[model samples]
Target: MTQGLDIEQMLAQHIARLKASLQQASGEGSGPEEGSDAWLLLNAFVENDPQNWHTLLANFEQSGHWLAEQGGKLDVRIVALQRYIDALVAELKQILSEQPLLLVETVERLHLLQSESIQALTRGYQSVTDQCLRDKDMFSQQLEHRLLALQRINGVSNSAMDLDQTLEITAQAIAEELQVDLCSIFFYDDMQRVLTLRATNGPRPLGGMHFTQRIGEGYSGWVAEKGQSLLVHDVMASPNFASEVQAYSSDYHGLMSLPIIFFGDAERLIGVISVLSQEPRDFTREEISFVEIVAGIIAINVENGRLYEQTDEQLRRKVHELATIHRVSSVIASTLNLDEVLQMITTQAVHLSGAERSCIFELDPDRRRLHVLAHYGLNANLVGQLYINVGQCCAGRTVQTGRPSMAVDCFHTDEHCFIRSDPFISSEIHSVLCVPLKVKDKILGCLCVYSSHRHLLSAEQMQLVNLFANESAIAIENARLYEETRRGLELKSVLLRELHHRVKNNLANVAGILSLQRRRSKSSDVRHILAESVNRVQGLAATHDLLAHEDVSEARVDEVARKIVGVASTNLVPPEKHITFKVEPCGIVIPSRAVTILALIINEMVSNAIKHGLAGQSVGRVIVRGREEDGWVYVQVSDNGTGPAFNLQFGENSESSSEGLGLSLIKNLAGDLEGQFSLRREHDLTSQNGTNTTGDGPAEYTVAEVRFPLVRRSRTRE
Candidate 1:
């Protein structure tokens, strides 16, 4: 009886120790302090009964729950653990009070057993407490790791990386913390049956074991099939576990598997994570829960990785589209060859869309058939050989509908069905998108893209294709416009050349007729008249020479003055006569009408200067000066020899003075230039001088200054 009492005392003390440990582990200090006498007495009671620990833990959990209840929602699991410890304390106290007393010798033995039991209980409690804290620490670290993995998988800091490098990092993290021989991830193919190895960490080359296994065939496959986590205490005990393939080695023992489910609009089963260990180890709830969270994060990361890759691919394709558009525009601008332009469009379409095949189909003028103007990925012999009826293939429908058309499954479409004559059926075109190349109502051609997978075209992709096709059509039209302009310029050049030739010949003929009249004339006056006529014709011929050589349709006023003065002086008058002919340096271009009028003005003025102004003198000076002021041409011809003097009355009528024919002609030509004319004598002309010089000379010197204005013509024929 004394032994029982001693055992009860020891058990009570042990129970107190266990309760104290639980309080410390649970971070509680309200009920009992860890090193107090009550704690020691509780430990003594627990030492007599191993069941005391369970009761203690239950009581601790209940007290914790009551304490947590005031704080609203709280950790129920923690409270349960704390309550179990509190019950343990109560049970030990009850056992201590009811037990009988023991003998002194028996008491000693009981004390020894009580001490052993207390030590064992203390170790067990401490182990569980430490494990709980460790699990929490591990979960925190795992969450941080998942965040970092997601960041890496997003390619936040890098442009791209190898899949193996990404997989290795993920697998190694799971293996190292779990103390597992191997950790691997397997993904189901589109069929959802075959599993492909994605990530693994363990022995060498184990990651390389990528055998296709069915979803329900092995441990990892079973987890995926169930869409839940599984634990195998021993791989040999599992019914569905395939040791031959999944076993990292013959010594492999324990295994755990979790299915990776991605959370999104489409909650897909991405893959399965498997952990294998060399020793059979019972997995705790924390371990199982940790793996499940890790798998979920991994699923999200993988989906993010795939989306990132797709975004990068789309960016590259957009850049290529811009580059291709610029290239085609440049090609069109540089050349007028229709075939070359078509070929460029086809080749760039293939490269930009990453299509296996590409072709440009131009609509026949009558819209009856589509002609294969250019093609890439087709044999040379079949390039132009392929044509379809207007309402036949995808290209034809695009033209007929005047809208973009896309066939997700070209081989299966009811309308715009596939043509059997398509060469190179090596890769069946699962998708076909086409855009009509139309300008206003004219359908020039259709630009098409082909892909190997069905439903591959997105709205944005269709828009890009349509934009490219529009660019192609614009390029073709630009080429046509360029060709037309070039041909027009060539024709204009030919016409101008012929016009210059005919003008020169006609002037020469007039000069020849004048020469014939000059030779056949009898009287001196007749001879002079014919000679002047011949000289005028020759002046026109020289004007034509300058016009043809200088490559201009109009005559230069300054150059015409020089040529006419030069030709008239040599032919119209005697060579022995000395004359100074001078003209201003400023140039003015005159059209055909002004050319003739200005020539006549210069001709009459210069001729008058030579004939009448230098009448009785061998040496004479003639100056021709012209300037434009207020749109009027002021022309002057002066001489220093004898002719009209200051006393001479100027008459405007041609019939009044036969000597006024030259003056009359000058006045008429000036009127033709839309100008007012006035003839004036030079300053040195005979004014009221001191004395009259010699015998009545023909007259003093003469000077003719004429003003002519440029007038613009209106469309109204007046």
Candidate 2:
């Protein structure tokens, strides 16, 4: 109560101060008012208290209740309470008026407190909003970076050329960019229902792509089968992701698989892109969308590469076909010898048709056996030994029936010929095709091709084989005709040689009769011409003897020269002091006409050397040397004895001995040989004394030399 009295005293002092001030200013007694702006402001402050606000608002709602409650307060007891309250109000106004700056300061302080709280709340909200914006910007930047990497990959146009390399590149890029522990691409083979690891990056296993995940069984495979993206936040926890060997030690987690689908053809899922991480990372909607775009690009490129390869293979096959046709045509156009042509055809057939071996078997006239007329792949022993009876091997059957025969697999067929039995049949021959080699209506032979595998040749290849065989049959027929023509020519030549022999013998008989007549009636001129004619006939006979004795279809130049020299030497030189003969070692061969002509030329030269050069001398030496040089044959006949003047003209008009006839014969023979003829003085011309002496003045010993070109003959006639 005494404390209450101190409150009363304080209020009285405030009221007294205000009353004294107001009386000095306006001199009016204005008490505590029923209505005032200060009172309303004070009431508003009291109403703002959350705990008492409702009760104060209720109190303010009823003015009559407040007045009735204060009506009994006019009593001294109530007057004192009211006076205390009035004094409290007057003191509150006095305090407010006396310290006007204090009132303003209190209002400003309260406003400052409210403003500080609002400012603190705003700062906190701004901080939270800023953090959210930064997170959004970071996400946007990460998306942009991912798109840039995808763009970089798309810029590589050459990747389309090779799919394996492209997949590998994409896998590696994603692994590096995403900081993934594992990245791989699996290509789905629809036919096999298996996913093959096409490309991989980061920590490749021992054998790359060794493990295969079945479609609808594992995470990647199921995603590919369903043609959708898949996210395995924890691989260990995923039901689809089973591990044979646990790669994680309970800490490793998370995996992502994206299906690579062809855009236009959505049902055809090409493959899947898989990414693995050690830590769990939530893949947002945007990230999955980006991966899908990458998958579409990959799928389209793989499809494109496959199409190109298929087209390329088809083109290659067509090129091979054209080459085979051209090769077969060339073989048909070239040769006329049947065996030679058939061998050529077999070789070309094997080469062009890509067969390992081939053969041409002809039907022997007996028709009992198929003869291997020509074989390209046969060894030396097998060439003639390889034969089969009619209705035996493929070739034999083709010949017997006059129809084509083919054994797509020789190994599968037990019907093999006895004659055709060989180690090669088991080791090398596994397939065979044979066609009849016929001329008009006759089956001449069978053309056969062999390989080391069953059905290795295709339908197109078989057609080509048939075409080539048909063309080759015509060539074979032409070769047979050529052979017949050659045999006829050879027979005619033999008959002509026999005729020559008989004619020479008849001429010899006539010469013998003429010699008897020369011994009986004897006009010297007649005898001389007759003897000369006999000598010419004898020369012809000697040529015929040589041609027959050599037993060759060709002429021998050496033999002709030696025989003519022997004949001429006997007649020209006496037995007591015969001219020493020096003949060069010879083995020169020439044509029949050239041989006869060369023999005559040698006869004349040797006769001249013995008769004139060795005359009036005993033990005289004559040398006959023949040599070939620079495509020509040179014959030199020389002697140490005296001879007729070489410089003198040697025709019927000249004063030469019977030697003129020999010289004339030599000139004619030389002309026949297509040779150059010349007569010159022998070098080192002397008597047996070895002194430099010209026994016959300017023309000591006559020497004849002839030069003729060597004509090369075809050794074997076609």
lDDT of 2 by residue, 1-718 (tens): 5533443344344544544433333324663233422232233332334444333333333432333344422133323323333433444555667656554543453344333333433344444556668989998898788988798667553453466677778887777767777777888888888887788776654345665667876777688778777776677776556461143333446677888877663467788887877787766677677667778778777766665565445434533543343333323322344665566678867865678888777777787887777777766575666667888767777887887777765544555643245665557677778888765568878878888776657765675566557656666655554566577975544443543354345435544654664565334544454555455446655775676455334565556766776666655456777566766555566665565557566766776666566777777766666666777876677776655564533322334354466676666556656666677766565433345444445434566677777775655121
> Model 1, range 38-100, lDDT digits (tens) per residue?
343254344545575455444444443444434433345334433544555444445445543
> Model 1: runs farther than 4 Å from truth?
1-163, 166-169, 179-182, 196-201, 204-212, 242-246, 250-252, 350-401, 404-436, 440-465, 487-718
Error of 2 at 232 (Å): 1.0
lDDT at 434, model 2: 83
Per-residue error for 96 in candidate 1, Å, reads 31
Locate the minimum summed-lDDT window of 10 residues in model 1: 686-695
The TM-score values for the models, in the order shown, are: 0.42, 0.39
Q: What is the lDDT of candidate 2?
A: 0.60
Scored by TM-score, the top model is: 1
In Å, residue 339's CA in model 1 sits off its true spot by 2.0
